[model samples]
Target: MLAVVVAVLVIYKANFPSYLYRYRLQISLSVDGQIYTGSSVIEVVWKCGPKIADSGRCGPTLDGQAAVIDLGSRGAVVATLRTGDTIYPVPHGAVDAVFICANAFGNRSTYEELPALPHLTGRRDLSPSNFPRLVWFSNPADMTSAQKITVENVANVIDSTARFTEAFVEITSDPVVMNIATKLPWFPALKLAQKGKGVLSMPGQFQLVYNMFVGESS
Candidate 1:
C-alpha cells in the first residue's frame, strides 16, 4: 500500500506543466590556468511531467549551450563562496538539482562543482577556462491552463525570452553587431555582458540570447 501511494502521487505530479524559475547565482571559472570570478543570473526551466515508465532518465532538459556572466580572472587559488548568490525556487516547494562539470571549451559548468574543483585538480590542478552557471533549461510542453498561469506569475520571464528572440531581427543595424561584423565577420557575433548588462537574440529563439550590455533594449 505504501508503494502504491507513492506511485499515485508521482502520476499526479507528472501531469504538472514545467516552467523556468529565475535565480541569482555567483560562480567562479577555471580559465587560462587560473581562476576567474563573476556574478550572473540563471533560468532553470522544469520538466512538465514525470519519468517515463522505463527510460531511467528524468530531469530538466538542457542543450550544450548555456548563459553565464563571465567574471574575468582571479589572482590566486581560493575556495571562497560567492556573495548573495541563491537557487531557492519561486512559488515554493519546487525541487531542484543543479547540473554542471562540462568540458572547459564546451564553455559552461555548474556551481555545485566548485569548492572541490575535481576536474581541474585532475588536470595538473588547473584548467584554462570553465563555466559555472546553470541558466535556462528547456521547459516541457503540453501544459494545462493552470500550468500556464503558474509561470505567468511573472511577466518579466516572458518578456525576457521575447527580447532575446527579437534581437536577431534587428541586429543588422545594431551598432555592436555591425562593428563586429565589419571587424570580424566570421566570428559568432556573441559577447558577454557586463555584470549590470543584458542579452538579446533573434525573435522567438530565447535560447540564443545570452546577457549583453552593449545595446539599448528595443
Candidate 2:
C-alpha cells in the first residue's frame, strides 16, 4: 500500500503542471483603412521539472516546457528554454528573427498565482507603456545591435505601409487569466504575422484588445 501511494503521488506531481499550465494565445491584427486581416497562434506548454537547458534537451522529452508561435502561412517561431527567460528562436527563410529579450511574462508569477499580462488588462489605450518590449532584426547580422521595441513595432519594421490600426488577443488556459492562475519559471515566446493592410500597432499609439479565458485544455 505504501509503494502504491508513493507511485501515485509521483505520477500526480509529474502530470499536474502539464495539465494546468498549458495555454493558447490567439491574435488578430488589422490596420486602419484596410479590409484584410492578419492572425497568429501562440501555444505554451509548461512541465513540472527542474529546468530546460538552451540545447532544447532534457526533461519530459515530450510536450516539454516550451513556446511555439505559429504565424499562419508566413512561418513559425519555436523556443525551448526556462520559464520567464528570454526566448531566441532561429529565424529561417523570409521569417525575420524575433526575440523576447525582456519581461516576456509582463508580470512575474507568485506563489499564489501564475504570471499575467497586467499591461493588457482592461486597457483601452495601448502604447509602449503597456505593451511588453521585444527585439526584431531583419538580417541576423543586425541582432547584435537590435534595440528593444514594442510588440506593435514589428509590423512597421517589416513594411512601411503596414501599420497596425487595431489588434485583439484571445488567451485560453486553465484557471483564471489577466488576474492569475498557476505559477511557472518562465512564460513563452511572442511573435507576430502579417495578413491585412499592415501590422498591429505603432510605438506609443492605438489600441490592442484582449479576451482571456480560463478553462481546461482539450
Candidate 3:
C-alpha cells in the first residue's frame, strides 16, 4: 500500500508544471534506532495574491531566499516549503537569513492529539489547503560574506545531523529554472535578492538537492 502511494508521488513530481512547482516535501528522521522517511506533494498558489491587478498596479514582489525543511507534520505537495509567510514577509524583507533545519519528525510527535486514531493513507474527501511546513526568510540584498558563511555552516550541520539523512522540497519561479542539484555540500542560495537563483544541495552522500530559479514567481 505504501509503495503504491510512493509511486504516485513519483509520477506527480514528474508531471507538475515546469515553471510553477507543485509542492513537494521529503523528510527523513531517526526515532530511537529506527529511521523513517516521509514525503508529500500539493499544488501551491504562487500568484502573490491581488498584488498583481489587470490594470498593471502591483505590489512589490518579495526578494528573499530560505533554507528550511519539514520538521514533520503534514501539508500538501509543492505547498510545503513556502517562500513568504505572514512572518517571513514578501517584498522588501530582511536580508540576513537564519537557517533552521531539522528532520521532518525528529522529535515532535508527542503533540498529535489524535495519534490514537487510524491513519489516513489518503485524505479522502478532504479540501486541500495552503501552508508551509518550515521556512526562513532573508534578503540577498542584505547578505554579507559573513552571513554567507553562517548560512553555509548551518546547512552543513543540518545535513550532517545524526538523523537528518536527506530533505526535499518544490517551489515556483517566474523565469524558467536553470539549475537543480540534489548532491552537494554548499547552500546554493545565489544571493536571495531579486533575480538571484541557484541550487542548494546538502552535504555528503546525503545532500539537499534544492532547485534554484531565476526571475519571478511562475
Candidate 4:
C-alpha cells in the first residue's frame, strides 16, 4: 500500500504543467587549449491551465546554435555543448552539476591526450572589444508581450596569423512578465517570467544565437 501511494503521487505531480522556466548560468572557456565549463540555476515558475494550453501558448521555449571558427589554421574549428544534468522536466528544486568539454587539435590522438596549461586559467568579464553581438529571434511577432536585454563582454588576443576571442553574456531584466491563467481552478491567474545567457571562446571568429519564447494571454 505504501509503494502504491507513492507511485500515485508521482503520477499526479507529473500532470502538473510549469508555464515559466528561467536559467541562471555562469561559464568559462579558453581558445588556446579548447576547454569549456559551466554551471546553471534552473527555476520553474507559475503554472497555467488547459484553457491556455489549448490556445497554443504556454511558457518560454529557448533554442539556438553557436559556432567558433579559426580561419588561420586548417581544421581548427570546434563547436561543443556541455550540460551538467539532463535538462528535461525542469526540476522544481535547486540542483547543481559540473560541465566541461575538451577538444584536441593537431597531432593529439584524443581530448584526454591534450596537455593541460595551468598558466592558461580562463578569465571572466574580461576587457571589452569590438566583436559584434549577434542575436536571432525565432518568432519576433510573438515577442511583443515580453521584454528582454543582452549584456556582453569580449576579450581579444592577437599574434601573427591567429586571433583569439572570448565572449560572455548577461541578461538581467524583463519588464513585461507574462500573465496567464492558472492551472488550479480556484486560484487566481498569476505571472511568469523567463531569461537566459551564454559564453563562447574561439581562436578566430565566434557567433552567439539567442532565442526566447513567451506565452501570451487573450
Candidate 5:
C-alpha cells in the first residue's frame, strides 16, 4: 500500500503541466492632445515544448518569432500580428509599437513608417530611445470612445501574464527623475517620455510606472 501511494504521487506530479504566464507592457501615448494608455502581452514559447536535449539551453530561441495581439473593446475580437523576430510589446495609446532587441549576429529592421491605424498617428507620441526595452507611439487624431475601450481591454490581457522580470513606465516630467531611477540597483529602468525638458517639472502628473513584479514565475 505504501509503494502504491508513492507511485501515484510521483505520477501525479510528473503529469502536471507547468503553465505559462503573459507579460503586460503598458505605454502611454498622447492622442488628440489627451494622454491615454494601452497594453500588450509578451509570450515566450519553448521551441520544443517540454522536450529536453543536450544543447546547453532547453528554452525557446531568443531570436524566434512572437505574436502581438490588440484587444478590442466591448468583448470584440482582438487584432494580432506576427513579428519576424522576438520583439517586446510597447503599448502606447492609439499607437502600439514593437521593439526588436539588438542581436549580436545581426540587426533587425522595422517599418520606417507607422501602420495605417485609425486614431493612431495624429494622437501618437514618440517614445524615448534611451531605454531599448520600452516603445511608444503617438496619434494626432482624437481617440473615439471605442478606441479607448479597446486599449483598456488590451491592458487587462497583458496584466494577466506572468513571464517578465521588469516593466517600464512613461514619465512625462524632467529627465532628472529618469536619471535617479536608473541609478537604483534594485532593477533596470526604461524611459518612455517625449523629447525636450518638458517632463522635468510636472508635479503630480500621471507618470506611467510599470508593475515589475507582475509576471515573475518564482
Candidate 6:
C-alpha cells in the first residue's frame, strides 16, 4: 500500500494542472506602405517561472551585419541581416512588457496599438474573438547614429518598420500567454503575466499590427 501511494503521488505531481502552456503570436512589417510578413521564434527561459523572449532570429536573415537597440529595463532589441539591406528589429522587453532600450539612441521610437488589418489575418480557423490586436513602431529616420550604426553594420537591414512588435503582443496580455498559437515548435508553454487570473482558453482569430519606420539609410 505504501509503494502504491508513493507512485500515485508522483503521478499526480507530474500531471496536475497540465504542466505546460502554449501560445502563438505573429507580426507583419510594412515599409514605405509595402507590407512584409515577419517570422520569429519564441524562447521561454525559466526565470522563477516561464519567461518569454524573442528567439533573436527574424525572417530575411542577412549574412554580414547586426544591430542592437537598448530597451532600458525592458531589455534590448537585436537586429539581424535577412535579405537585401533590411535589418529586422527583434525587441526584447521585460516581464512587465515595457520597452527598455531608452538610451540606445537619440531619437524617440514611435508606437501605435491599432486594430489588426483585415487582409493580414493569417489564421483562418481560429475565431476572431479570442485575440486582441495591437501595433508598435520604431522609425529608422528618427534613430540616432548609435541605432543606425548597429543596424547598418549588420549585412541586412532590420525590419525597422515593424521592430519587435509581434513579441510585444503576447507579452502585453494581462495573463500573457506566449505563442498561444503553435507558430513555433519549441516554445509550447504559455507565459502568464502579473498573476492576474486563470488561464484563458478561447476560440477565435485575432489580428495585430506593428508598423515601424526608418528613413532611407544614408
Q: Rate the local accuracy (lDDT) of all candidates.
A: 0.26, 0.29, 0.28, 0.26, 0.25, 0.23
Instruction: Determine the C-alpha RMSD for candidate 2 after optimal superposition of all C-alphas.
Output: 14.6
Residue 195 error, candidate 3, Å = 34
lDDT of 4 by residue, 1-218 (tens): 99999998777554544433232233334435554433223222334233343342233222212222322322222221211123443222211111111111111112222223111223233222211122212222222221211122112222222333444322222232322111111112121222122333343322221211121221
The number of clashing residue pairs in each candidate reads: 10, 6, 19, 0, 22, 41
Candidate 5 residue lDDT tens string, 1-218? 99999998877644442222223334443323333344444432222222245222223222111121222222212112121112233333222212221111111211211111111211122233312222111221111211212333434433333122222422121111122122222212222232222333234322332222111111
Instruction: Provide the clash count, candidate 3.
Output: 19
Candidate 4 is scored at a TM of 0.20
Tell me how many residue pairs clash in candidate 6. 41
TM-score of 6: 0.23
The reply for model 6, stretches above 4 Å from the true place, is: 1-6, 10-18, 41-218
lDDT of 2 at 54: 26
Worst 10 residues of 6 by lDDT: 209-218
Could you give candidate 6's per-residue lDDT for residues 1-218 as a string of tens digits?
Answer: 99999999877644331111112233333344444443222221111212136222111111111122333222223332121122222222111101111111111112111111111212222112221121221332222211322222222343344222222122211232223123212112211221234333223311110111100110
TM-score of every candidate relative to the true structure: 0.23, 0.32, 0.24, 0.20, 0.24, 0.23
Best by TM-score: 2
Candidate 3 local lDDT, 47-74, one digit each (tens) = 2222133322212121222222322322
lDDT of 2 at 84: 19
Stretches of candidate 4 exceeding 4 Å from the true structure: 1-28, 34-36, 52-57, 60-218
Q: Please identify which of the two predictions, 2 or 6, would achieve the higher lDDT against the true structure.
A: 2
Q: Higher-lDDT candidate among 5 and 6?
A: 5
Native-referenced Cα lDDT, model 2: 0.29
Q: What is the lDDT of residue 52 in candidate 6?
A: 33
Model 1: per-residue Cα lDDT over 1-218, one tens digit each? 99999998787765653433333323343333343443323233334443456432323432111222232221111111111123333222221213222232131333222212222321111121222212221221100111111122222422233211000000011121122222212213343332335543343331222122111221
